[model samples]
Target: MTVLNNTLTFRRGLTLKNRVIMSPMTTKMSFFDGVVTQDELNYYSLRSGEVGAVITAAANVQDGGKGWEGELSVASDKFIPSLSRLASTIKRNGTKAILQLFHAGRMTDSKVLRGVQPVSASAIAAERPDAETPRELTEDEIYHLIEDFKKATERAIKAGFDGVELHGANTYVIQQFFSPHSNRREDQWGGSLEKRFNFINQLVDGVISVVDNSNVQNFIIGYRFSPEEYEEPGIKMADTIYLVDKLADKELDYLHISLGDFKRVSVSEEYKEKSIMQYVHEKINGRLPLIGVGDVRTKEDAENTLANAELVAVGRSLIIDPHWTSKVLEGKEDTIRRVLADQDREELMIGNGMVEFLDFMMPERLR
Candidate 1:
């Protein structure tokens, strides 16, 4: 068996049966009201149980922060029951379930927010096509948002999730507060990099406080982040290193560096020599577990990724074949489907929304 079958134990005392983790992906299978549907349950039920853990798609912590249609939400206690169903579905076969939480911030439009203006650290617009200039959050609103995140963690615990992953990556609200392109305020939430870290700092602290008080034991909290942004004056590798250094000292379980390719070198010119994962691995220095992910599709890929990270996360490959981990573990890797066939859609439990998204985003992989 490959190193992917090795077990991993988080600092908080939680253990995974293996090192392979299923990366979070948006399925868009939930109902319009953010309720979990059977389709979504079926989707997870089929894909889970083989991986050590599965981080679910980004779920909004506040109603106003909804990122897309049919996204999951833990914004209110009322969602606990529906989310419980999701947690149980993913927990089948002893696999850990982590609910990813985030706010779209300016990444969302008023249309997604139902005519309400999106909010961010500042009034800046995201560096994307037709991005709306979001309303700057008031101090009170920021505090309320932190509380909302804490409440979301409470909901996750009550729903029986093994943990919650703070979706601080992908230019979501947490990253927006840290990005120079998005956060242009002079207040405590912006200005210097240290100040910009206040939101996430408080967020981690809040989530930890909730977990500490809860009856559940070994509930993990992971942070995911994009290392750099392409926009001028955006997040650079140095900024991310600083953030990593700070996070290493926190009560975090792991740091997941979001990358399109696990072996990709730095995006910024100064740090172009080594892969981004290499840089982060060096900086983290084993203080907290690191999860490496990007296009990992085979046993060799997962083994190579384990070189730099304590855990290897597989995303699209899991979409192509939910039994990927089982097949690889059973020495049946040769039988694993590397490409998606038209007939594999329903058989693979890929949601209609996800199929359309995959077609638009990565058509080369689908036949």
Candidate 2:
């Protein structure tokens, strides 16, 4: 079998049947109470059994962490039952289900938060024109938040998921703690780069402790990160290299980089010759597997990405074609959907909320 078709085993013994993963994307299809709804179960069910694994939409770890309307919640025991159904839907077809954990930090507005001001490592606001400055998290609050993550992981294991992925990208709390623009604290959690990483250091350690005791066999734990930031004094490739180096040493099953284009080059001209994933793979140096994702629309795209990273995740492509991996592997790549239409919804099992989000965010994809 080819590299993309071969089963790859991780450090902890969990193995993927293939290299294609369904990258986590928000669906806004859950219930208002943060419970997994039938719509969500159906949506994921349609896409499963084709890919090696599915990293689900971000599940907020606390009530205050909800980033958008209809987001999933693993913050409490009450959510576990529905979460179990969601997990089984994906895993029943022999695909691994990984629940992604996240906290929005300052990315959300007070209106979405229901009058609660968003919190971050520091009080600084994002550089976006309409971004609101978040309230600074107290030292005690920081510890509590880390516990929230651990608890969420515990819940994931309870839900019978194959693993959990820390949503460390997309300007969320984890990225906020690492980004210079977002985290400006003078305490041990901020200031120097090493100090700024303290939160993640403690977070991974705490989570590993939970998994260790749970005895959940072959349970995988992964971290996803954005390689470079565009903000002033933001995280750059060099900084990401250092960060990846440190994370790779932490016994993680894999490290996934969040990027829009799988073949995108470095934002800084200094490293323009190589793609960001290539640079990160170099830094990783076989310490751990890396998952590369973004705009991977074809069999060739996934194949090429696998050259640099051990696994390839596709979000938009899978959205347009639910059976993408199967089609490619079956030598029916010509039948793959590169774009979508209103009439194809039933065939692809597309959900209404998914169509709306894609329309507003990427209208061109819909013919």
Using TM-score as the measure, which candidate wins? Answer: 1
- Tens-digit lDDT track for model 2 on 195-308? 989999999989988998887898999999998899898999888888999999997899999988889999888889999989899889999889998778888889889888
TM-score of 2: 0.97
Q: Each model's TM-score?
A: 0.98, 0.97
**Model 2 Cα shift for residue 120 (angstroms):** 0.5
Report the poorest 10 consecutive residues by lDDT, candidate 1: 357-366
- Cα lDDT of model 1 overall? 0.91
> What C-alpha RMSD separates each model from the true structure?
1.0, 1.3
Q: What is candidate 1's TM-score against the reference?
A: 0.98
Clash pairs, candidate 2, are none
